[model samples]
Target: MKKIPVLFILVLLLAFWGCSQKEKKVSVKKVGPIDPQMVQDQDDMTWEDYKPIPEISWADPSIKPKRGFKMALVAVDFPDQPFVITQPKGSDLFGNPQIDPIKREDVAQFYRDFFIKPSDVNHGQTINGYWMEQSRGEFGITEVDAYGPYQLPKNLWEYGLNEWGQNDFTPDGSKPKGRMERDVDSLWRAEYGDLRKNYDAILRIYASYDETGVWQEFGEMKFNSKEDIPPEWGNPNPDKPRWVATRYVPWTSWKAGAMQWGISSIRQGENSGTITHELGHYAFRIGDNNNNPYVEPYRRAGSGPWDMMDRGCFNGPGGPHKRWVVPAIAGASMPAGLMVRNRMKNDFLTEDDILRLSRDSLAVTGLAVANITARAVEPFEGEYAGVIVELDGEEPHDRTPVDDPAENPLSPGIPNYDYYSLEVVQRIGYDSYCPDNGVLLAKNRDKESRNGGVNQFNCFNWVIDAHPEDINMVDYDKPNGEKVMRTIADYRQLNDALFHAGLNSGSEFEYDDPYNRLHFYIIDLHRNQEGILSYTIGVKSLDGSGAAKRDFQLTAPKTTKESVALFTLKNKDKKAGLDASCFDNDIYRLAVSTEGEGLKAEILNELAVVSSGEEISIPVYFSEEDGEKSDVRITLTAVSESDPSKKMEASYVIP
Candidate 1:
């Protein structure tokens, strides 16, 4: 072999060493715990701040609907119970008057405007407006014909006292009178023979409150114990206890337990009802996404307060307890907008509205990044309303372990999820009543079904809670002053489930699922001039380094404030390497450590994203507990989410 120069051999060795170092992977360092105090709450939001949707009325001559539904609104009252509208009673049942009583014709017009016309009573919100907004003006109730403040043959208690062990407590000590549906439909049919065939659906506005709205407010929530329930609120038979067995909880006041729950069947509702939720079922066939909240062996909520099909139906001015208010101005009034999954199920979203990918394809595609607009508004052109990653490939594509919810209620149930979904929620439109606004991440199934086993509840959409630990919120105080904590399964437990970006934002910026071989990152948040929210998000497979060559450079720390150090991280790749077509942006997870006595350090922004040749600045705040001067050494590390091997670290020393 020809002799090679030693200098040339040295150059080859140096190049090989540099290349090896570039491909070397670095283990991720543990970051400090997120500050619980940093989490944001929706308490500041009020009805005044709500972003209004353009009002659409059924009576408008210029308005027309494409997939319009013509609904018939029939009001019926029992012989024993008169319409609350005509009576205008107090806060308590049949007590002193609160608002002035209206005539029967006025009641009919009230509902007419409530359902289809934008009016002051409905907060400029109507069923037609809700549907039109949700469907992007594609579907709505274009016409609603009002009929009948008619009277039914049976007594109010007869039809109302039919559920939750209330039949035995009837005033006559006889079986409950009859079905509200049969009696109400019979009355409507008697007047206009089989007239229901003319409309898409009939909305039966009955005489009292929706049982769901009053059950807790009047039951255990009202009285400390069953014995404390007043006789007036009890069943007619004095021998029977004032409380009766009810759904979820063990007992409730007889009156509340007896009242019928609002149902999709002929869409029967009451003065304080979740009519929109019923309309969801009546029109779209969307099943309830709720679980038994007050029961034992608690299970986590499915979609929680983020979806209309869930407890989000009870969203309005005040929290759930205020649902008993008449004319439905409080809870169960303006329900949350439909989530991406339900919207797709209802065909409300077009193909362009969702960016779809396959879990198997992600391995080849590297990391996928997109900006997702809030579900309540239209996405900007070329952006998506949501992202869906289909769990495709192996027989059991979802590798999540099935743990016992009885042991850990926070456990992800069943491990049979079909896909993952990501979308943003903003306090705009109907979502104005939602608890907070942030990126919503969840595991979902193609079809709605129960998880079976101990957590035998609906398992269609399982939201990944950012804070899985108990929120430790008190649901209510007993009459005796004992506090009743909200259960782990309570839908409100997910009130803080959203994932937010940036440091001190009162939410997590990223989630890692080693079992599912996926990592999700909420890189940043954006709000348009119109007050619509969107998030720049990234999803990468753990099994592969992304298709693009990932590299970044961190600048030396600069002191901006007395105890704050700022650093700029720039994506060093001048060009999209290897796969330019697939390259989006580089996301980095940052951590900081301090070496000093009584000193603590926190990264204001723990996660960052930079497009090719772009940069972002991160700030680290340091504090001393003892108020004593000491030399401090701060080490900041950045790890590329696309390729963990590309890691960089910088240190700043303060004397």
Candidate 2:
């Protein structure tokens, strides 16, 4: 049976049969850009010049064998190279370096073949190509049309966070067309990396998208004429060709594409990965995991370097080349976001390898998988918790975060800039629901918080979706500009907690006060005096100070007896007890998950749980994390069947 492709990914988002949200508590930690050496550079120099571009062999095929996807990327003149090279020597190599008069015709022929060979429409697989065609994963010619804002010039090869002032490009004007910035940090170069040469150009962005929603880039090919680029583009100090791929792709839209499809001799030098990368996407909706914020078809891995999904990022592979691969959806396959946990435990894997491989694998998982995700967070501690809570009927587990699917849709068109959360996750610590690397492939988007509230545990990122298994609650902070009772939370223990606390019998339980009066236990009040847990008793209430009243409200303190001292309000106010007049005159105690943080209910126009509730219900909400996945310190701020605020907070480790 054949499964038809859906209309669009976002469309499915709106109509998901059962949507749930899993969140990660990620702290926003800033990181500088990666150095130029960290980025991969692909040069398909022609044999006429150095050795002609080498052919990448993917012909062996797996499973379906010949029936599998077939693609080839033929660079017109081997411009941008994804490999390491020494600075250019003073060969002063010059000669109207191979210019095709009918470049337009050549380009046209290239596409003709690209569409004709396997018939482009999904040879027998998905229609409209990969994401199925975002990065397409074909080693074909590419340009700004597909790369959109992420395109880099064959002449301007380096990548990282980019966005340079025009001045950075050729302050000297030696290369009038344009110049690549050399002094910028690795990040700036990637985000705003600009064009280097003046000739026609084509850049192939290798991409991979797993079941999660992250697009990973593993390779790229930028082609242009060195001659077209001014001397400045090459760098006055000159280190290997700044743009190894400046072969023949001009800034113009010509026919050089014909050679890219393996038809023209002038195009023999094209980077095969360039074409192959696009095909990879078409075949799998896989993105480039390059980890270079500026480049596209970016592929990222959380661990293991044996698959094409593990191509770019920390898994540099020494030089440019995305040669290995694993079945993205094998029965025993791990979620791409968390492939690293296994790698890290294996003797063959090193910390450095884990860093690179995991990032790459996660990036792939983040891009492709609709259910899981991984974050490449900076190393942090305690701030993160790994726990699974039941949601939509799922059971709880001890695993950490899956990738944040809400923010990571992995399809093309969405810029890598939106990926800041990945950086934030990488900064804290890496974990995975599936353990592809240490990251999780997440689902369940937290969409309601955007309207605004004092939600401390809710996620701030509007884009990412969390997992359904981790029950992270909605949170908000107090508004009254005051701190009541100090509280402590135990978010990490959610998975192990049974959350079985509730009323023992019915409404009438015997109780005696110091007055020796046997009174019926009508209402349950919390320690801090924030709220009252009234029983569903016939309307009857009499108020008095201290232990005299059962339905109204009162004051108290101390709600913890944990082996480890739980919490103390750094700022405590003796005057912070509950104001009974604020709670609903009628109602029973509220039951919530152990992951429950805080609560507040108001009467007519008056509000007892205003911004800062009476010390009774200690503040329940906090700040939402800006990034996707993270730890949520949810404080149980409510009137339990047995207690009230008294600063009773239970931490919930959420998305």
Per-residue lDDT of model 1, residues 1-655, tens digit only:
1223222233344344445544322111223333232332333334665666433333242466689899888898777677776775574473422356668766766777776776676677777877777887778888888888888888777777777666766777788745788778888788889988899998888877778877887888779889898998887778878887777678888878777777887544455547888888889888888888777788778887888898888777766776776777666667887887889998989877898877877787677788888787778765689999888888898888878878877766778898999998887788878877788999988888888667577768888999788888888887778998889888888888899876666678889988888888887666565556677788888777545677899886654334456677989764545443335677788999888765676775667777887886666656555566577788889998777788999888766
Candidate 2 residues lying further than 4 Å off, grouped into runs, are 1-72, 78-316, 319-655
Number of backbone-clashing residue pairs for each candidate, in the order shown:
2, 216
Using alpha carbons, what is the TM-score of model 1?
A: 0.86
Model 1 weakest lDDT span, ten residues long: 1-10
Q: State each model's CA lDDT, in order.
A: 0.74, 0.21
Candidate 2 weakest ten by summed lDDT: 210-219
